[model samples]
Target: MRVKKGPLVVIGDTLLDIDVEGSAERIAPDAPVPVVDVEGEHLRPGGAGLAALLTARDGADVVLVTALADDPQGRTLRSLLNGHLEVVRMPLHGTTVCKTRVRARGQTLVRIDTGDGRALARVTDTVRAAVRRAGAVLVSDYGRGVAGTVLELLGEVRAPIVWDPHPRGSMPVRGCALVTPSELEARRLCPPPYTSPDLAARHLTKALHAQAVAVTLGSHGAAFAHAGGHHSRIPPPTLASGHDVCGAGDRFAGASALALRDGLPVEDAVAVGVGEASRFVEGGGAAAIRLQSHEMGDRPRTPMEVAELVRASGGRLIATGGCFDLLHAGHVSLLRRARALGDALIVCVNSDASAKRLKGPGRPVVGQRDRVEVLRALACVDAVMVFEEDTPAQVIERLRPHVWVKGGDYAGRELAEAESLRRIGAETVVLASVPGRSTTGLIAAVQET
Candidate 1:
């Protein structure tokens, strides 16, 4: 589905989710519980922040309105979200909300939640103005006070509203475009224990007086009931076992809101939501929601710009130069290993003219634009630049990367760029080449056939 060409305004509570993963080998001596030997930890945006992120990732401009405290976690949350979207933070008196989960081998063993759920400071004039000007509004109420303010301002907004409801939060006003709730959340609206998704959706639609209500049924897909007396079910795409389902609902809400804002009918929008959530789960769930460079709303930088960015982030800069006329597994392996050696990798590609000079006439199977695009699409390559010089000396001097990577083919030979790299005090490392994988070999094989 295509995203609309306007800003999606998300109003709700912002939360920090900390996932501590490791091995739980032996049981504790004092208790029967297993002791987890933590291997790593990841901090992610949760609640409304996640909804905003998903919307932005779906190719929509998003504005996030939420409350944050003046504590360290709040500072970290702001830092993490700063470049991702247009965030309007209303300072609250309490500490920022945080949920920490300890997991062993993908199973969450324990969770610790910290924060006050008291009312936040009232929404500022800035948030009110943003709501009025938004192309669409997504209310992700995790029972926080921000949703209350958004509900108060709904009358001022003419945009379509998609509300992901919480039992603890304020009830949605009549005429809301859609209300999405998980089956568990939907059950709270109707009779307890054994309510079907269809009945729950109908109950929600009638209770909220919304245009439609969608009840998400995890693996079974979603059930939708319209005020106009139409009902539909949108099935999920096939997902692998043990998939991360944590943020699937948020992905659905965000994508569906974008579709509805683009004027898709309720059923069609629900289909888009199902598709987005399915993709998210099938792609490894929460693991797929990490921060990406494109989410910062910045265009690809030039060499000078990249240098400045690397310096500012205080990350190691790894550089490699190649023709990359035809991308192959060998190129991918080298790039991945090079990225592992540093915080970021910059691949210097030979310009079209330089490629022709180095590889002879009609050598480069692909043009420079397509070559750069292909390289940039690889997760291992953070940035790409084109150089016209025969050697990458000019680019090397400009970047002065911390590490200069070369493939195994150059291990025993005197590298032409060694002197240039030495002048900049950059260390050079040679990585092993993958056996039987090369662009040249592929070209020769095709020619033989």
Candidate 2:
């Protein structure tokens, strides 16, 4: 099934991911180590940001609460997420957060972190505001930051909280929606009679006073004990489906929170979350933002091109573009709507290099090819194209579809290809959109907690 329409929010320690990939080969004559011939370097907004993005891509109007420094990385972060999501930049007092990866043959071998391991600064007000507006919140504990004070601040907010506990804390929130712990983390949080995974979930449920308790057992999937004396085992649904496994847990936690908040049954939500997680496991996380219009055949590039195609074929053209790294719900909705406007839709995807250049040290959560393929597979999309420039002006000029579309409220400003389109006689329409349904908001929410 596709995503449902709704509102959700995520709070956690945010991050940016730097992925470096290369082919592995034998080392030099003197050395005996394997040398990697670097093929590419990529940046992705991750952690809580990715989690929120996953939930949103699954189809929800989502918001994110995260921290960013007052520096270049932070600027990059803002720009990278500018059109994707709205951000509540809780200053970190330093460079924006980052994690660097060194990979070979599509396998990640090493990761280097660069950030001060401290909770986000000036967050109480932000937390209150977000909690007041959100349907749910996930307290992401990475052990790098988000201390007791942050938890305390979160407590004051009335929203349902889902705690993705780090090993450092005692109890998370008093009555959180659920407290999710890995087997290792649960081992530290659970008491006697909670020896096995099931027993551990049961004990933790009662001990924490939360609505439920979930213990993630990696490949073994997950086990849960709800507040109503109900117990079940939930295996990760998307574990075997995606590529990198690094952010699997975070994605699961996010999806689970969203499902629960949406009022789906515990087992059902867990299973759905697991399914969503499986989808991510095959990719990294799910798409951060969805620029959906149509999944038709690839043909024209511009509104004029679309109009001309339509005129020639007795149809109309619809045009849109975005980072579209993951093609989530927002994208799907946008694409579907775009298609509704005409007979065919034209989509321009930001190239990986372009996405990296725009999103910062870590962003575009998924690879360009994967994103393109995903868009191509969607039933709503007709044609897809890739643009290397940060903006889609050149692409807009070339494609020249019948109409140009974008999500959100951008009524006053000139669109990237508007002037050119007008000069060439193409129709321009600004979609009156819902705020907080963007990739940036998804990223910010995932990164904050």
Tell me how many clashing residue pairs each candidate has: 0, 65
- The CA root-mean-square deviation of candidate 2, after full C-alpha superposition on the true structure, stands at 14.9
Model 1 spans with C-alpha error above 4 angstroms: 1-4, 117-121, 191-194, 292-449
lDDT tens digits by residue: candidate 2, 1-449: 33543357666667777767677877867777668787555555677776665554445667776776667666666655554455655556456568888888657777798876355446567666766776667777665454354666766656567888887643587888788888888888866445698888888888888888878876667888988999988765323344566777887888777777777766676676565555445433322122322222465544455556556654456778888865556678567546545557778888989999988877788898888888877655767788899788887777667677776556567776667788657766544342246777777767886
TM-scores of the candidates are 0.68, 0.63
Tell me the spans in candidate 2 whose CA falls farther than 4 Å from its real position. 1-6, 124-126, 191-194, 236-243, 284-449
What Cα-based lDDT does every candidate model obtain? Answer: 0.80, 0.67
Candidate 1 displacement at residue 254 in angstroms: 0.6
lDDT of 1: 0.80
